[model samples]
Target: MSFIPVNEPLLNGNEKKYLAECIDTGWISSEGPFIQRFEKEFAESVGRKYAIAVSNGTAALDAAVEALGLAPGDEVILPTFTIISCISQIVRAGLVPVLVDSDPVTWNMDVTQVEAKISPRTKAIMAVHIYGLPIDMAPLLDIARRYGLKVIEDAAEMHGQTYHGRPCGSFGDISIFSFYPNKHITTGEGGMIVTNDDHLASECRSLRNLCFQPHKRFVHERLGWNLRMTNLQAALGVAQLERLPEFVQRKRQMGALYQSGLAGVSGLQLPLASTSYAENIYWVFGVILDASVPFDAEEAMRRLGKMGIGTRPFFWSMHEQPVFQKMGLFCGERHPVSENMSRRGFYVPSGLGLTQEQQETVIDAVRTIMDS
Candidate 1:
């Protein structure tokens, strides 16, 4: 059998048709009809009043932080188990990132612990929906409301998942999403920021376009990077956004298959099937080695790689990151849950394009390894 890759985007939809239109119309640059259309449609999908498209997810986070006008020394609490992008933008804006532990079940930020971390310096709570599960937003939002803290939701891994009846991106002051090939939808590489605040929307638009002055095209009042997404990407995004519901259903189905097939497998802790807040979309069908397991994810991944199966390790805790340690940030801070996950957690092939036969092959390979 050929090697099963970790992620393969399903581009059978209108990707090609949109790309062709972009090329034919010569509207391939950042400013084009598709860009506006994508921003508007995406905002509507997330129930936001405004959406700003950017080059990638990191840029989206950066723009949101900048648009919030957070002064230096302001603190933003976020999950230590999330990607570096969540903390990087805050750090770059001269803001402090207050790290929180992940919930053992949901693998999302422990919303209960958020209140203890909030200080007078805390200006915002950056809630990152991990894997396919949203952070329990009701409590998070309540805490934010009580404390008057801004909420920045990073829904990068959660495209279709919802909390209660509301969408994942709809709960924040500013929410962001990524359209990388591995995400629920693909624009090859793109991202978006959504918000209801008109002033923030305008600030993000300016930040995305090099902070260009409205009256003077060549002048800028404040410094900003050219983190604009191209019309080519927006065209593809528009097509993808139309099929988001279908994509979400497919992801849930894939997650169900993995959960059923991998059930009763010893020494493996599967991703949560469902929480009280929302069902898991199984972004990549992750698994963690139990303490009884003899090796960490690195060894398991190597063994699987040799068996022609692809896998990816979980994110390392930000508190343990050497870069952060050197900067005297997160000093003496420790999150045991996040640390353990980094060592033992990994996700197998669970992309939208995965086939049944391939999935069975993956299950058999994993069983064979564990049984040995």
Candidate 2:
């Protein structure tokens, strides 16, 4: 059999058509029409009043952090189980990043632990929706409200997901989405920061455009990086946004097929299909080795690779990261669930472009590898 990669992006909508339009019009820069259209439409879709497009998800984070006006040495509590982008911006902004472990079942940050981590220096809570599931946002939001802390929601993996009938992106003071190929909607490499706050939205717009002064043409007051998204990327984003509904439906169907196919498979722990508030969108169909399994995620991925299958390991706990450890962060800290997940978890081939046949091949290969 041919090699089955982990994530094959789907771009069968108006992507080519839009790209052609961009090419023919010679409007390929950040000033193109699609930029504002994508931003406006995306903001409306997510129930946000404004959206500022940026170069990538990390840039979106960087912009969100600065726009919120978090001062240096302020603390931001975030999950240790999330991508480095979540904490990296916090650290880069000279803010303290406090760690919390993952909920073993949902693999999201343990909302209960968040309050305990809060200190007088804590200024915000960064709630990251992991994989396909929105974090337990209601409680997290409540925690933020009670503490008067801002919430920077990382909805990168959740495009159309909801929590208790509320949209995922709408919960935070500022929410971010990524348009990487693997996401439900792809802009090749782009991201957006959305919020209802007018001042914050203005701040983010300025931040992504190098903090250019509105009145002065060539002057800088405070520092900001150029992380502007191009018209070409926005053109792709506009097309993908049009098909988000159908794409989400397809993702659910694929997740159902995988769950049904792999049910009762021994020594593998599947992602929870749903919580009381939200059904997983299955951004990626992840599996965790039962502690009883003899090998770790690396070994499992190695075996899958040999079987012509592709897999990706789960995020290593930020608390235990070498970079953070060297900085004397999370020192002597032990988050058992996050550490165990990093070792035992890996996601199989789950992408918006996945086909039934390819999914079946992945399933069979997973069984072959795990049953061995």
Candidate 3:
């Protein structure tokens, strides 16, 4: 049997047609019809006023931070249980990162803990929808409104997720999505930043292209980087955008299969679905091993690989990493819940195109390993 992957991108015939057209027209560069169509279509899909395509998710984060007009030493609050890009962009923008602990069940940033971290130096909050789950954003948004702080939603792993009937991207002052090959959708290696604020959108568009002015050649308005997405990538994105609704539905079905299959397993706790008027596009069907479980995430992954089942551990806690420790960034910061989760959490095979037979094989392998 072949090794089952944790996540895989599904490319249909529509994507191939668009790619061929882009290649034939020799319009595979930055500016083209596909780029415009993708931005417009994607923004409309997520209920955002504007969406700017970029090179990758990290670049999207950098653009969001730059648009905030944050001064040096201003802090951006975010969960410690997240990828490096979340914190890297904050540091890149010359802002401090106030890392917070996550709730054990939801594996999301604790809203109760966010208020204490806000100070005069606090500028914004970067809420990352960890794994495939949407963070509790209603209370977070209320806090943001009360404190007059910005919210940057890292919706890279959560393309089709929503919160309280509103989409995840719409909740933040600015939100970003990744179209990497393994995400909910793919455009090879592309990203997007969504915003309703016209001024911020204008700034983001300018900054992505070296802040070029229309009137003058070689004119630069501000110091910026080359973060533009290619027309070819956008071509693929446009095709994928049209099929998002169906893809989200398939993803949910896969999640249900995993829950039903693994419900009786003693050592593993499946992800809990949010019923707060929001739907999640289970990007990765993650499971948390109980403390009494015989193995940690790494050991379980090794055993699963032996059974031809591919698995991946959760993101390493940013505050506990060596790079952060050497920088004296969070030497005394303690997030025991997220720290422990990093060791025990792992995701099984859950892709958009997963079949029932494939799911059964994975579930049987996990049961066999745990039952031993």
Candidate topping lDDT? 2
Q: lDDT tens string, model 3, 291-335?
A: 989789999999999999888899999999999788888978789
TM-score, predicted candidate 3 vs. hidden true structure: 0.97
* Candidates in order: C-alpha RMSD to true structure: 0.9, 0.8, 1.2
lDDT of 2 by residue, 1-372 (tens): 788888988888898999999999999999999999999999999999999999999999988988898889999999999899888878887999989999999999999999999999999999999989999888888988898999999999999899987878898999999988889988989999999999999899888887889799479988888999999999999999999889889999999999999999999889999999999999989989998889899998999899899899999899988999888888898999999999999999888877899999989988898788
The runs of at least 3 residues in candidate 2 whose Cα sits more than 4 Å from the true structure, single-residue gaps closed, are: none
lDDT of 1 by residue, 81-186 (tens): 9999888988888999999999998898998899999899999999999998888898999999999999999999888778996888998899999999999988
Question: What is the clash count of model 2?
Answer: 0
Query: How many clashes does the backbone of model 3 have?
Result: 0
Model 1: weakest 10-residue lDDT segment is 275-284
- In candidate 2, position 5 carries an lDDT of 84
